[model samples]
Target: MNEIDPFKLFLELQLALPRNAPGSARATREAFSLLPALPPRPEIADLGCGQGAEAFELLRLANGRITAVDLFEPFLEKLAERAEREGVPETRLRVLRGDMNDLPFHDGEFDLIWSEGAIYLLGFEEGLRLWRRFLKPGGFAVLSELTWLTDAPSPEAAVFWEDAYPGMGSVASNGEAAARAGYRLIGRIVLPTEEWWQDYYMPMRAKLAGMRRTYGELPVFDEMEREICLFERHADEYGYVFYALRRD
Candidate 1:
């Protein structure tokens, strides 16, 4: 069996679905709601800005310049295309491909860091510590992470993410970790319910049906079909926790 490409799995899922990127509705609302009012012209970084969903949202909120960073070349390409289509200047939207775990930037480089459904790519606690250094004093980090509601997850869930996301933890534990990491808690919210799953899985299932017709049994089609099933099975129980953290 060819090893599954988890990143690709996420990419297809999101590209095929939603106005925002994947994950909980409540989480996106929470993160956006918690944003500190930008300066007259604040500089912001959208870490892991896959396909520029959150970046576009921030552009609306900040009305300021944005640097959208992602590791995937394809997503960055799409982001560039989006910039042109949306009439956002190439200069106004800067796209960079970089490692999230080892961010390449000087300390205090940005006023705000917008991360949605990405911190779990690295260990959540580890991201809390390392990414903090990138923020200026009193700078903000608005992020959403996969959070467990139950301290002990269902056996199926535990098994699912253990293979998928080993770093997953409950919202309370993550909040405690952020506090310990020296970030003042500005705000937090549990992701919204219906908008979360419908946004991704519903459209993805549609895409899979389309691909199945076009390709007539290709490997990619099969992979997406399986992913669609998984989402249908578990989306209700899984959710994200959104947090707005500030440097103390």
Candidate 2:
């Protein structure tokens, strides 16, 4: 009787998950460990922080304060509730509703900039370039991005990403892009496949399964199913890579 809104459905499916992308506290810890030393209490910024997965991990790993920024009020709200439930003080982890593209923080404000699986909204190189100003000299930015792990992906996987993310680059290409954006590589780690299933796709599968009766016919449903299928079958061709970098 009525046309279903796709963006609405997308959020409905995504916002409830613990992680909006493939990542874990162990991954965060490993990435952080790769970085050069920082202030005893670093000032950190977590951009596009959906539900604050890495932000919470940063709480345990560093003595610094974190400013977790996300444009979606709902995601920020969930992060806030989690923070409160975990007994994290506002002073330690301040949740702010803000756009990563047009952040309000002053230049050279943070000792580290962390973004798990959310930088694609601004394109990979563009996000790294734009966020450079927010980092203090020698500060670090660790982000997880979907990267082509192989040059020859299966046709199905290639076709799917060409439509979904034409700009997706191999690990080398992204590393060069990061260099052009004024960062030197500290370290990079390909996220293990289990990270994809443990918090992201598996939970998404459960939600999508439950949503089928209501949204089955929608193209978004088909798109998500295809995505999961692609990842499951051709995982070696691509994966989320945590790139640990430092401001030049």
Candidate 3:
């Protein structure tokens, strides 16, 4: 049996997010519904786009142009391929390999910026502050992030994210940080229960099974299986927070 790579385990978890599921597509659409009144055509950028799922949707709605950005090279390759296959024009779709901490675009370059479940990769507050300059005046930024409904998180969940995302914060705290960073909160949504976990976990358990068969004794698989169980146990304490913000 081959050894299970921890990085592979993490990738499996990320790929399983609800944003990638059919039911959760509505959430992504709902998040975009908060855009400012503008012309039918607008420029949009999807920050930390894993494989362009949300970016594709934005392109359809904006009827203008979309730029997808990510740090991972392979994911960007897949995104580009998907775009081409979808009949999106080479001119209309642009993919960039860049860091979200310091976006490569000039100030006020995009009319709308979309980030789905990716802010935790960078500290939430820092990402809000750092990426604000990239938005056009009155431009809106939409993001989905993990947050706690209660002030306190379970010990297990807290410990999990502490290592996975050291800079995460609660929804209230994240909202305050957005305000401090000069973004007006236009809207916010707390995800419902089934919308969050079932979309991701069902696919993930299958993947884990496949991995276990391929890599029999790998300890990483055991670790990931345990984490999934814990996430199930604490499903009600936290959720994905979708926020719409405009430059103040």
By TM-score, the best candidate is: 2
Per-residue C-alpha lDDT of model 1 across residues 132-248, encoded as one tens digit per residue:
888888999888887877776667767877777777777778888888887988888777655555666577777777756744556766655664565567655567767888988
- Please list the Cα RMSD from the true structure of every candidate, rounded to 1 decimal place: 3.4, 1.1, 2.6
Segments in model 1 whose C-alpha atoms lie over 4 Å from true places: 1-14, 19-30, 213-236
Q: For candidate 3, write residues 89-201 as lDDT tens digits.
A: 86788999998887878899888888988887786777888888888888888888887777678898888877876677778888898999899999988767667555666
Over 96-209, each residue of candidate 2 has an lDDT whose tens digit, in order, gives: 998888999899999999998888888999999999999998889999899999988989998989999898989999999999999999899999999899888989988988
- Candidate 3: count of backbone clashes, pairs at least 3 residues apart or interchain: 0
Number of backbone clashes in candidate 1: 4
Q: Using lDDT as the measure, name the better of candidate 1 and candidate 3.
A: 3
Reference-based lDDT, residue 66, model 3: 86
The RMSD (Cα, Å) of candidate 2 is: 1.1
Task: Please provide TM-scores, in order, for all candidate models, with all chains considered together.
Answer: 0.84, 0.97, 0.89
